[model samples]
Target: MGVSALAEGGSGTSYPSHREPDGSIGIKLLEASSNRKNDPRAYLYIVDHINPGTRVSRRFEIRNTSSSSQRIKLYPGAAEIRHNTFVPAADRHANELGSWISIDRPELIAPPNSRIQLNAKISIPKSASEGERYGAIWAEVASPSVKPGSAGNIQMINRVGIRVYLDIGPGGDPPSDFRIEQLTPGRTEVGMPVVKATVNNTGERALDLGGQMWLSDGPGGLNAGPFRAQVGTTLAPGYSAPVMVMLDDRLPDGPWQVKLMLESGRVHHTVTGTLTFPEKPATWGLPALLDSFPLWALVIVGSLAAVAVAFFLVLAVRRLRRRRRVAQ
Candidate 1:
């Protein structure tokens, strides 16, 4: 089903927005939210090699574009790098690092065209050991409820966050690194081909692992997929996990070569290997004439060829005799 919207005064119509007069709300990490285009860490705060027992602060801005007022909620949650993605913990407080973050203003009301600046303090404990921790400060806006008698009274909310990374200790540098132990090519439960990379965290710090992948099928090096490595695949020191990239589309069934490039902060690594598909090439019920066969099949075809040759020779001899009789 489709729906339409009209202007309040029946003057003109356009798509709907949560706010009246199509107003909007914006959240930015200082100047802007992460465009995620050129700068991967544009909206993220990176406190590199900062010693424990120290304090730091992070600030952000939220603006209301609508004519009416809006209430914005803020909170902090633990985050991890896994499966080539940035994954955050649930609303519940879980990560020990997240406990160090203190949000002074949890809620604020912003008038139309107003920008509100908020601050959060990171108070690291003196006993904090050396390693890296992941977390995020999130801002959210929720839509109002539906009318009294509607099909569903569900409300929609949109949220965005700024990622935070802290390195703790006196000489706090946990060998910012990890390694790709192996690349195994196989299929998923649904029979889709996937290249699974086994990775190990060799450093003392937890690493958020993710990367890009490229695949070439067959001898011509025909490119298939540039699948990305799993993001937010977090691994503590002496830990391991499987980072998988699924070939979700249809491609020629053959041997393929996969190249992967992985990175965490300043650390980056690239690896390449071969993979074979589990499924065979599609055949439209055609006979297995070109397919590999047993010796019995070969012998049967040879026998049929010899029988046809003998029958043709006998017919030629009979025709020659008939011609001789007519001439006599």
Candidate 2:
């Protein structure tokens, strides 16, 4: 979800990384499917749905940002969505989808500060199952210090990859959607404003949750943010997770109209509510009454109800006047 870089160590810990000027090898998607051209996720990873017996191809690029030549190994590895995370298998393991994927070049020597494009093809057998499969196309580089077959030495491997989400079926792609269950406003221990949205994946496919939140109608009519939801939270079907958006610390804490939009590919949902942060740190406050409804919709309904009430009152007055005249 965030910018991926070379992951070091097999220590069973997840480390965050980004490309730097000091030389790093990286991987990226080079092309997206024509059918999925409009979907942002398609451009980031190998996301698609195809029949069991068909094959699909995608292009990707690997770059050597160092000053010296590097030996890069290309391969497909096992991956799974466990506990709402895309976990890559350890040590070049293979899954169903990973076995099906073939890189045109398994290994290559990359010149310094050079780029190489390669094609990865996935050929599904006729017996493939009718569900989604997960894997990754990885580019790994080993540290030069670790000589080959150095049994007693520790070998550090740094690799980057693009995720794969491939669904096998006979018909069209499955529906992808989600729902926002609740919104809570809070402050961090240091008093930074934050909003936590509980989201549920209510569809047949997994969701990559990402979106922006806007705050308006605050104290003194002040407004804030189109703040982004921290990326990297993925939800499997029937799963629920919290998506959070942190705001500027300088923002005042009372009665803000919040609008949040979340999506996975083309499926999107918008939620509106009223929130206020609590006075204490690391505390949460509930949304105001009718906070789930948009303000504009509420105003329209209220206006219609007022007109109906006025018309009924006018009829009542006329009927009373007629009764008085008849009695006279």
Each prediction's TM-score versus the true structure = 0.59, 0.81
TM-score of 2: 0.81
Q: Using TM-score, give the best candidate's number.
A: 2
What TM-score number comes out for model 1? 0.59
Off by over 4 Å in 2: 1-22, 91-94, 145-152, 288-328
| Model 1 alpha-carbon drift over 4 Å, by segment | 1-47, 63-68, 77-99, 103-105, 111-117, 125-134, 140-159, 189-191, 217-221, 280-328
lDDT of 1 by residue, 1-328 (tens): 2111111100011111112224766655552222222333333343345577877666776668878898877877787665444567654376766688877798888898887888877788888886677777767677776887788877777665666666677863556567776676665666666666777777776655667777775647688666766544656677888876766646655566667777654567777666566553221111112223434457889999999999999999999999999999
Question: How displaced is residue 124 in candidate 1, in Å?
Answer: 2.8
Residues forming the 10-long window of minimal summed lDDT in candidate 1: 6-15
Residue 125 of candidate 1: its Cα lDDT? Answer: 85
- Per residue, candidate 2 scores C-alpha lDDT tens digits across 89-167 of 6544656876899999999999999989999999999899898877788888886566668875666787788888888
